[model samples]
Target chain A: MKRLSRLALAAALMLALAVPVSAQVSDGVVKIGVLNDMSGVYSDLCGPGSVEAVKMAVEDFGGKVLGKPIEVVSADHQNKADIGANVANKWIDVDKVDVIVDLPNTAVCLAVQKICQDKNRINLISTGASVILTNKNCSPTGFHWTYDNYALGKGTGTAMVKEGGDTWFFLTADYAFGHDLEKSTAEAVTKSGGTVKGSVRHPFPCNDFSSFLLQAQASKAKVIGLANAGGDTINAVKQAAEFGIVQAGQRLAGLLVFISDIHSLGLKTAQGLVVTTGFYWDQNDETRAWSKKWSARMNGRMPTMAQAGCYSATMHYLKAVQAAGSDEAKAVAKKMREIPVNDFFAKNGKVREDGRMVHDMLLAQVKKPEDSKYAWDYYKILRVIPGDEAYKPISETECPYLLEKK
Target chain B: MFELIGIPPQALFGQMLLGLINGAFYAVLSLGLALIFGLLNVINFTHGAQYMLGAYVAWLLLNFLGINYWLALVLAPVVVGAFGILLERLMLRKLYHLDHLYGLLLTFGLALIIEGVFRNLYGISGQSYPVPPVLTGGYNLGFMFLPLYRGWVVFVSLVVCLGTWLVIEKTKLGSYLRAGTENPTLVQAFGINVPRMITLTYGFGVGLAALAGVLAAPIYQVKPTMGADMIIVVFAVVVIGGMGSIMGSVVTGFMLGLLEGLTKVFYPEASNTVIFVVMAVVLLIKPAGLFGKAS
Candidate 1:
């Protein structure tokens, strides 16, 4: 009886040891969760299009790394922060998602950022526009990819001011993202010798921009800076055209313009509008090729900068995992900073200690209806703002990561 | 010369004009709601989706059938109204003997289904419908540049509201509708076909919303959710104007729109919430609404 008990104890010990070993190996399957605005106003900017972009990146990377398969899962947060947090929590605790990407709204992104930090997972923000994500809210495992408000303001505001749009009036969306965009664009406008006549704040997701447009027209400013994004920007611009704000010689400076907005507005109403972006699908041969593959999967709708950023960020994240030979969030994040992103979307893009991905931003104008040769040929590149010059300086940020590094 | 109450006269007047345009939408929509509620005693929640459908139908007509804006202005309502008639016959007609909430719940579910279908097909970014060539430009009204399309919207909406009022108040058909609202069974006892009148009334009310939708297509983009938010405010206007009266709904819609416009000029932040605020105040003072008969 004693000998039988000893054997049973040994079997139990072996099983206990084997459980962890099997768990470790099974965890090798990397899961990437994309939480974004799937059906809301920002859906067109980054929705199913973004999910398709991420899948294309995975397939392009041969669908496997470290002898383990990579999996992509997505959920619509419905543009609610609490819902987004719940989704992020489920992804982290239940699904063991290694990375989260393509968060669009600033409020949702911030909530997900906190959840990611608590779970110690990697988060790559591809579509969110808040600069605070890299400043006070920066996380060690969080990387702010694509464009931010500072970059947009520097690229579009400075250029517009230089092109004789000095006097400014703003029609801002009343929310965190809109407030941040307006604040940054106004700073840039003031820095470039432009005078801010007056500004009005309108509710987010609002349909009627007529009153706000009238208030802007009353300012009689040379430039009406649209410090909103996605649907709000589109609505404001269309209403401005209806009010003949453009014909009266008042320019509309879109602070955070996306390719999707231009597409929806069409070239006739959206012509002569100067905006900044990190990626234009028709920028070069490589981009065109990648965008073609992306468009094929996206129902022939060309990928927006946010969608392209998803592809670029996913590809880079995978490369970092391969380089580190591990899926641990900290190691993968450290490796992400060590490597330079040379993807088709961004060349020589580097993730900094403050979690800002520095990449070249392009200033482009909507092509006239007469200049069209193809369906998606919408932009005429006016200038290329260097990556280093476009973003905010590291010394100016209050990120704890930078302070700790010093 | 350009200033008014610390704001430019141009800005104030421009905002007022915008308010009037918005008021036109509210007036037409509430007028429909009141018309239906009078006889059916069921608040048609699907009214907004029907409005959105009107816009989409107009767009489809223009894009697929090469229908001009003028023709679509008449045809889209007819199409949407026919759908309304079908809905009344197949579904809404059965719930007349049940609780009023059943009809409300039924229409609410229908609204969700309609909105979801459109959202699934088109997504929510909204498609642009160009202003007709005749209404493309605007007149520099000295204080404000009045876009011809906007002016046309206000004018057409006023005519529609007045025409509806006249038809319901001054004609023989109007007497029948008013009588049907008071006692459907009594009217049916006289061989008036009250059920058919109820269905036609629902269709006409729905037709009014669709007409507003066609008018709004160029002003606001053709979006599935365009009428979703507008409908809520129109409901508030109905509540404030007393849902019992057609003329009351029309007047309250335009007046509230102008109030909201003035709010934007004076305090931009309160423009959105002002309508609800006024509704609360009106409800507290007169529970039955301004034009509603006391029970």
Candidate 2:
């Protein structure tokens, strides 16, 4: 019996030794999770297109890092904070995922950020617009990519106010996104010596806006600022046209809009409406080239700002992991912050210590019906706000991560 | 004291007009929901999706069939109602003998399937429908501009709601429906086809929802999610009105819409949640709701 036990022990030891060290050393494969609002308002921004963007980045990086193949997986968080946290925890603890990317909704992004901090994993937030991700709730492992509410509001509001369409009235959505946008745009309007006469907060997904439009008309503000996004924005704009609010000498400023929203509104309704963002398909030669490739791959849906950010952030994460020679979350995260992320979307963008990725923002105006020489011709680039001017001052953010010593 | 917080006359009257417009939609949709639930005993969670389907049908008719709004206004509801009948015959009829909750579950599943397919195909972005040439412009009231289309929706929905009420309350078919609801087996013995009545009742209810959708398409974007958001508020409206009387649902839907408009003027922060708060208060005071029958 003693001889048999010794032989069994030897056999087990030899079997363990025969297994490749790469599997045990975390060098065989790196796994990343992409979680976002897959079927809600932000779906177009980061749904299937986002997953494809991440996959493309992996392919661009040769699909391997540190002698290991890289793998990508994704889930739809459905815009719920609890659901997002659950997915993040499962990705980290069960699947042993090293990174999570492209969380869209602000509440969900904040909740998932806490989970990443606890698990010591990296989270690349590309679709969310709240500044708080890089503010009070910032974590060393969380990186805020793409545009946030402050950048969009300031970029669009200041430019429009400077153009002498100063008196403003807001038709805002009733949510965190709308609140933040209204606050930021209000500040910009006030800062530029423009008066905010009044504002109306509409219920989200409200199908009719006659009452709100009536209030806007009564306010008689020169610029009717729309501090809403997605379907709400389109509905508000369309109703405004029906009410003849635009022809009544009031301008509509779409503080945050995507190409998809413009498509829904059509050129006639959306024409001359000014908005601001960090990405547009027709802005530059590089963007157009990348968009053409992506459109072909995505069956002709143009890449939104969130999708572009996903591509840039995923490429950067893989490159960092390759440079670090390990899938250890802390080491790879530190390398990511140190490296300047370069892409077709944003040139020489740097991830700040507070986890905010600083990039140049753009202002674009909706093209008129006659301006459209082809399909998908939505916006014409108005101006590019430099990186320093686009974002809030670093001192303004209350992130603890930025306060900590390097 | 009322005037201090009171809406301006122009604003009040304008908002009330706006309220009526919103109430028209609420009245039509809730009426449909109440009717379907009354006989079919299914919540028809896909009611909103069906409404969206109505709008998309109108859009497709215009785009593909070269049918104008007038034609679409007639055809869209038929198309959507037929689809509703198909849904009932295929899936909903199977759950009648089970607990009422099963009916709710089945319809909810159908809702998910319909919404999922639409989201996958068209995405969340809205599609615009042109205002018919006749209702394109607005009439300038001294206080506010009133779009002709808004006025039309309110008028048409009122006529439709009353017409439906008349048919259900006065007609022989409606009496048989009422009898069948009271005693299905007895009604069958009385030489009435109870099951077919239930099926047609569901179809009628779905047709009402589709008509509302057709009316709404020009005013709102033809989006996949248009129905999902509206349905929740309509549920709140149903709870507040108690869904006991056809006229009660219609009246309450308009009243609450005006109240919401007033809230937008006075306390903008609570505008989104005001209806829900009213619902909670109503539940606390009268569990059966203002017009609802007590279980």
Candidate 3:
């Protein structure tokens, strides 16, 4: 009877060992959720293109991790912070998503980041511009992958001020996004020995820029810096032409612009305009190759810098999952910070302990009519702002994690 | 010291003139919205889309038909207004008895459809419309330069607003319309076609928005989203002005625009929110609005 009991115990132990080995061979699928402004203003940059970018990364990585298929799902957060947070929570709990990607709006990203941290999920933020994500409210579980307001302001404003566009006037959009852009750009202007003659804050989606344009004209500033993006930027540029602000020797600086905005303004109106960004479509052979594939998927719309960031983050996340040998969120996240992220967008880029994937930024100028050779040709490379030079100093950031470590 | 704190007369006068120009657009758009809401009780959320259609129609006229701005300014509204009339007769006329929110929803859907189609075709870029040669250049007013086109906007809008007011208030047709709004069944008994009047009123409101759009084309780019943003602010304007009286909407629009301009001069940070702030204050003091009727 004792011998029979021992045989049964041996059989049970063997069964338990077999079950774990089989589970290790095929555990569970890695689900990643991409939340963004799918149907709103930032749609062109990080909307459908972001989805496509993630799919490309999955495909390029062979679409499997830990012997399980990879799955991607996306939603339009509609640029609302509350909606974004809710979506993030549901994606983590209900869908069992391991990562959330491409949150565009700063406020929405901040809210969604908190949710991801609470749920112990990874968040790869690509489109938001607020410095606060990495400054006051940085999270270990969230990675700020692309450019921010301070980087854009420092790269564009300081460069323009040094280039002899001394006096500045601002036509700012009235929103958190606009306010941050204006504040950072204004700081750069002052630091570079440029004087901000005056500024006018217009309501978002304002149609008639006549009053604002007239105020800018009256300021007599040499450069009329547009601290607005998307439709606001397009309107300000068009009206500046109508009001002849450019003819009066006032240069226009688009602090944050997309390829779509440049295409809308066309070469005639957008000529000689300087802007700063972390990516451009026609930057190099690798960029062109990636853009060519992305264009085929995005209905011929060229990939913006934000779109490129989406690709980099997704590729890095999948690689980390593979490295960790599991789809568990905490394990994958720890692997992410440890691994060096290398791609066409970045060379030897490392995801910092504080969850910032540092990369190079570019300063580009809109080409003149004569410089254009095709339909969507917009910008010419001005200078390659190095990765270290493009972003704000990490020492300057007031993030609690960074402070605690120090 | 006086020159430092107090705006120079030239600058202040120039800004006020600019304010008046902006007010012209506000007045025209608000008047159209009020007219539609007062009679048909439809929020016409697609007002901006219709305005965009007017600009695009003008652009198409100039691009394909070789029509000038002068011709487009006259014919574009008519074309857009006809589109509005058809929309009213076919779709909007069916929703009069349903919840008012449905009308808002339907119009909002129509707006999405129009904007999406435009964005798909033309993309989200701005298309330039040249100023008519006649209105090109600026006139020096000793204090600042006034573009001729801006002055034209203010003058033309004033004429249109007052003309609309006169038509709705002083004429026999206007009286019949007012009677129709009060009791459409009774007006129908008097041998007047109330439904036709309602349809025409919607068409006229759409036409007014289109006209304002045409006026804005040269000053602003003819873009898909031109109207989407403007219409929201106009809604706020409509809410604050209290849709109770036509003239009240006009006065309130101009006053708020001037207030916004003043904020730009002094506290630029609050410029965008000043109109909303005023609306809140007015709502607190009188929930019916500054000029709105009690619901």
Error of 1 at A187 (Å): 0.9
lDDT of 2 at B124: 83
| Candidate 3 CA-lDDT value | 0.84
List the candidate 1 regions with Cα displacement exceeding 4 Å. A1-26, B2-4
- Tens digit of per-residue lDDT, candidate 1, span A1-406: 9999999999999999887556442477989999998888888889999999999989999999888999999999998899999999999998889999999988998999988988889999999999999998999999999999999987889999999999999998888888898889889889999988989988776788888887788777999999988778888889889989999999999988889888888888899999999899999999999999988877889999999999999999999989987777888899999999998898899999989999999999999999978998999999999999999999898997678888
Complex DockQ per candidate: 0.75, 0.63, 0.43
lDDT agreement with native, every candidate: 0.90, 0.85, 0.84
Q: Which candidate ranks first by lDDT, i.e. highest?
A: 1
Sorted by DockQ, highest first, which candidate order results? 1, 2, 3
Summarize candidate 2's per-residue lDDT along A1-406 as a digit string, tens digits.
9999999999999888766443432636789899988888888767889999899889989988877788999999989999998898888888988889999888999999999998888999998889888988999889988898889889988998899989999998888889899999999889988989988888775666777878888887899999888877888889888889889889999998988788878999989999887888877799999888889998887888889889989899888887776677788888888899788988889888788889898899999999899878888888989887899888787887666753
Candidate 2: what lDDT? 0.85
Worst 10 residues of 3 chain B by lDDT: B1-10
Q: How far is candidate 2 from the true structure (C-alpha RMSD, Å)?
A: 4.3
Q: Candidate 2 at A403: error in angstroms?
A: 2.7
- Each candidate structure's TM-score, on Cα atoms with residue i matched to residue i, is 0.96, 0.91, 0.87
